[model samples]
Target: MTRRVALGVTGAASAAVMSGCGSSEAGAGGNVKQPEISSPIDMAATQDVPVGGVIKANSGDVTVMISQPAEGTFKAFSSACTHQGCTVNAQNNNIVCPCHSSNFTIEDGSVTGGPAEEPLPQYPVKVDGGRIIVG
Candidate 1:
């Protein structure tokens, strides 16, 4: 009986530890579906994205990250991380995946470090009347 109790306790402890190892954050579970945008998305005003900075826009079905590497020059990419299909949730000058710590450059979505072998998929973006439009 004592042996059986010890086994049960060990199993419960193992399950608890394993559960904590995975992220509960959205898009971090690897199975989370990436948002898909079929139509042009109005992301933000050109002035909202500072030079050398990035902004994330969610348009119901898709998430896009827009970055301005230089004044009046705008670029866009899918927010999904290339490492494990996790959506990037953090950013500074770089996009960061909260799942496995993958980091990507905002200039062209190139991988900087942390297990991502491919760059984030790029999208076309343009500015019209000071609004950033992405498709």
Candidate 2:
């Protein structure tokens, strides 16, 4: 009976560790919440977004990545990684997810590499009088 109990406990511990190894959570036991945006959000001035650069913004419960690939052009996409729903936290020429190393293109949010199979969800955005509006 003692040997059986020890084996059972070891198996359970191993299963618990394995379960967390593939979790998509950004941080801390998969407790990260997906941000939600129900209404249009005004993010920042157009001038603040540099050409060939990107910016991350959170509005109303949703996190978004905005990119200006060139002059007079802007695009927006969800900051969540499609692979495991982890929030993307890093950006270079592409948006990056720290949780799984997924990289997405700044132009259209398409998966460039890593484990993500789909592109980041896109949101409609417009430049209104120097303000960046996303919905």
Candidate 3:
């Protein structure tokens, strides 16, 4: 009886650890509230990304992409794809939706494939003091 009980506890503990591995540190135990991060960003030394290019910015629970329509011009949008809210990681190519293979043009965040009808929400960004600020 003692050995069985010990094994049961061990199995339960292992299952708990395995289940918690599916989420980020803030939500390891589930119910991860969105974090509050309003600190200003310092984008000094960042190059002026021309059109057809992308720059990644990490803020809060989402990543921001700063692209441009032409040299010295810039546009910012969410890195998360609208479909299924997947993180679009392919910076060199169209923003891809991982859940359903939806594609989005980097220039305007238009849906190119999959079931997503909405584009990524634009986030305002500007260069100040030689640093890019996303607000």
lDDT of 3: 0.61
- Which 10 successive residues of model 2 have the least lDDT summed? 25-34
Residues 41-70, model 1: lDDT tens digits: 888899888899888876666778888998
As for candidate 3, its clashing pairs are none
What is the TM-score (0 to 1) of candidate 1? 0.80
lDDT of 2: 0.79
- Which ten-residue region of model 3 has the weakest summed lDDT? 26-35
Residues 9-47 of candidate 2 have per-residue lDDT tens digits of 999999998887567554422434445667788987898
Candidate 3 segments exceeding 4 Å error: 1-40, 43-45, 48-50, 60-62
What is candidate 3's lDDT per residue for 26-118, written digit by digit as tens? 212222222233664543234755456776556445456677656666666666656545555444645665545777777787888788789
Better of 1 and 3 by lDDT: 1
Per-candidate TM-scores read 0.80, 0.76, 0.61
CA lDDT, every model vs. true structure: 0.79, 0.79, 0.61
